[model samples]
Target chain A: MAGLLLSPTEKVFILHGVQDDYRSDGRSNIDYRPMELETDVVSHASGSARLRLANTDILVGVKTEIDVPKPDKPDCGKLEFFVDCSANATPEFEGRGGEQLANSISNMMQKAYHSSQAFNLKQLCIFEGKQCWKLYIDILILECGGNLCDAVSLAVKAALFNTRIPFVKAALMDGGNIDLQLSDDPYDSKLLDVGSAPLLVTLCKIGDKCVVDPSAEEENCSVISLIVGLTGDRKYYYPKDADKQQSVESKCTTIGMNGPGSVAPKTLKDAINQGIVAAKSLDEALGQALLKERQQNIGIKKHSYGFLK
Target chain B: MPGPDLLSSQGLRLDGRRPNELRRIRCKLGVFTQPDGSAYLEQGNTKVLAAVYGPHQASKSKSTTEGVVVNCQYSMATFSTGERKNRPRGDRKSQEMSLHLRQALTAAIKTELYPRSQIDIYVEVLQADGGAYCAGVNAASLALIDAGIPLRAYACACSASMAWRNGEPEPLLDVGHVEEAAGGVVLTVASLPNTGSIALLEMSHRLHMDYFKVVLSRAMQGCRDIEIILDKAVRDHLAEGWTKQDVVTI
Candidate 1:
């Protein structure tokens, strides 16, 4: 992390603002900065998305491969997360400098998606106890502006939503071998059911108060941050259709704490509650945006606005 | 032995491109604000983003009095290629690319003017459909220009491969991934088009001595065409921001 040099007075000012539930940028404690999101940005990827939350730019691409399922979990698919902290984000990340941070973020995502209720791996299964789809979720951190965990999770979920898996038929061959045939048509594919995918929310503990989506300056003011990953509701994902709505309770899939500071038991509990609320709202907004984009893409050629826009 | 059919019977390449035609290039400068300069470039399906930082004081171990040190790093996203990559950087291939990038960009930058300083250029490939090194060079050049670094000239790079069209030697410009993987000789050239000077030239695989010149010339021609497009983009970017400065001057 690049440290921001702040005088004691500026730190006190930020502390006082956080105590008042008002931030320097006129945002509430639970308010997140405006973000720009675009999907299907990378043509070579099965699914891809780019999200710019303030200045923290994250690009995620999902690539699908066919492989044998694990012996213990023969009926489920695999999801692997790889995070690359690009040197372009900062000179400090050059060479192997950003490996520690990248590994931490990837581990966080891996844990968040580990729960079956959060993401059903059965959807990726091609053949029982045999061939299955292995998705590689590659995350590229182009720029850093704080609140990276939240942004990365959001981008990953969006990328998964945009992913299209081709239909494959498996035939039982002699000696327990399976022959697979893939569809030739590009559009003849099924979209992943990402309605229950988890999203992360980071609550930075500033002066005994926590804030969501802290800016870079605010992040410097805080000594610790609690990250909570909560599963999303499908009802919010398809609001226009009542039949598709399911009243699934949002569950906590994973929780992580960063920085060296420690909090009291009561404060930690409150922060986790705050993070859950924030994640739910964030998930709703993301689901609505993705649904709208998909609606617009129907029967029309999608004009990809990648890095150009 | 003749290579795979890179050129169809109708004289079109596998991607429906003419032998001398370069892929469509869309580029934008100043794509990021944190770095001193940044640019994004898309050459066909290959996409690269480059960022440049500093002409600041160099670290003690790498300092030099004669000229500024140009440090380059080339990394590709794990999902950029058809096969998933375990590590994004520090690989032998990426390290070699970093050195080649430095070699090409050092030739264009006026390094002597900023003695004992270091300029860092980092390029990240988001999607690699082939000619990633060429796209990296082009993106880095635009990023250097955006950083207002003094340059001798715009350094552009393009790759060319020799193919046969009706038993006649035909040189292909801007080889794509499929073409490069076809086991043909790919000649990559980086040059300053305005100065008519070559910065870096590399060839993969072997070609006949008689046809090397033709392939190299075709790559050079592609560089010239790319230079024109880059120059126009720079001018357009300048025009967009000059309005505010013009009012202040008045």
Candidate 2:
């Protein structure tokens, strides 16, 4: 939005397009742009993913560290989100310029994943309040076209899905202190249950209608946008459970409105419902992509397509 | 350090490459549409992305008649290392890296042509296995070329480490994270290989003065090798970015 400038007539053009339920890019009001995702791209981190939604590029890496659980929530593990707005995205993001946007996105993700129904932190617990795995989810904003919140959340979830927490080979609790041994073998690890991970859907309000996946020009034309974080169903992430009667339903875990303009209660409700629908379809596609990637790594070594492809 | 050795009896490094073999360098130019030029490069497992903004009008305060001002920022992802980093940039180490990157890149760009202009180069390390600085320089070079910035030559950077194989000191090319952590001496060199001149040279962990030349030469050789690879990538990118045009000679 900083570099992109649209004239009054250009803004009107976008507004009319949104009102017609068709966008400048020929997408419907509820449709998202084509997205490309790949998991396990970074070798340094335990789990990593790169997601490119049109021109917005996001790379997320999940690093697991052993630490003592908090006294208040000893049974639960820690999930900390750190967002880095790289200058590669835009010059305005250079140095500490992007810190404000980065903090807002990270905080939104933190609030979204805070609910137990959204992400089960107990799976990261190692020795029942003594020690647990602390996942440091670091999201790097490499490029930004628009709709950064949605891209970051999707990449985070994919990285979490690819994350593997090593099993505790040995543990010893000594008066107020604990020592734990983790297996170094890469295979001696457990995959996280990220099926219920939250996905954020940003609906930009242009004119009186809402549009999903707004481009940079559309973003500048809109005065306000709502980011809805919805919980994904386990059956979507794990296809093995797809055969069973679907019991889990999509739920709104968090709702965040960004911008100076405000939304009416009626429009907000409709936007929330629209977000839920968009999230489900997005989740289904992401699940299929992750499953396909997992199957590809079954018998042979994965020739990583990191940035080469 | 005592038990795990950097080199085995077969003269192979820990990552299975020969002492003088550089890592597999795979690179692509113009990976993004936002920046004037952007590239993504992976040297072994260390991946880097670089974006070049402009040689446009310099800011009022920074404007000068001397030449183009080269501004560089080097940052690594928080999860790029074995341990999660607290911040991506602005740390002492990354700030030093930023200066070093500017030093290396400034030597290659033709600054005199763009008087009172500024070129901003931003390098982001997505995964730093080792020799992250070298990878950053190489990626930035590609991005600069993609941006169509005139340069003296291709700026390439590489690192070398001394590994003892069968009681002999063997200079290893493209040091990896494990070897760097093995208490070995690492010598990093950023050079314009075609110009046959060094732009920046840095060494960490003391090494014998007698073995310094061998390690330095290894790193320079690595730079030359990397330059060739980057040149090919640039050529490939140009061919891809071009679209067929019908001849119009009226």
Winning model by lDDT: 1
Runs of candidate 1 with Cα error greater than 4 angstroms are A244-246, B1-4, B242-250
TM-score of every model?
Answer: 0.96, 0.95
What interface-residue Cα RMSD does candidate 2 give after superposition?
A: 4.2
Pairs with backbone N, CA or C atoms under 3 Å apart (clashes), candidate 1: none
Give the lDDT of residue A277 in candidate 1: 84
TM-score of chain A of 1: 0.97
Question: Which whole-number lDDT from 0 to 100 does residue A142 have in model 2?
Answer: 88
Residue B246 error for model 1, in Å?
16
Error of 1 at B183 (Å): 1.7
Docking class of 2: medium
Candidate 1 CAPRI-style tier? medium
Candidate 2: TM-score, chain B only:
0.94
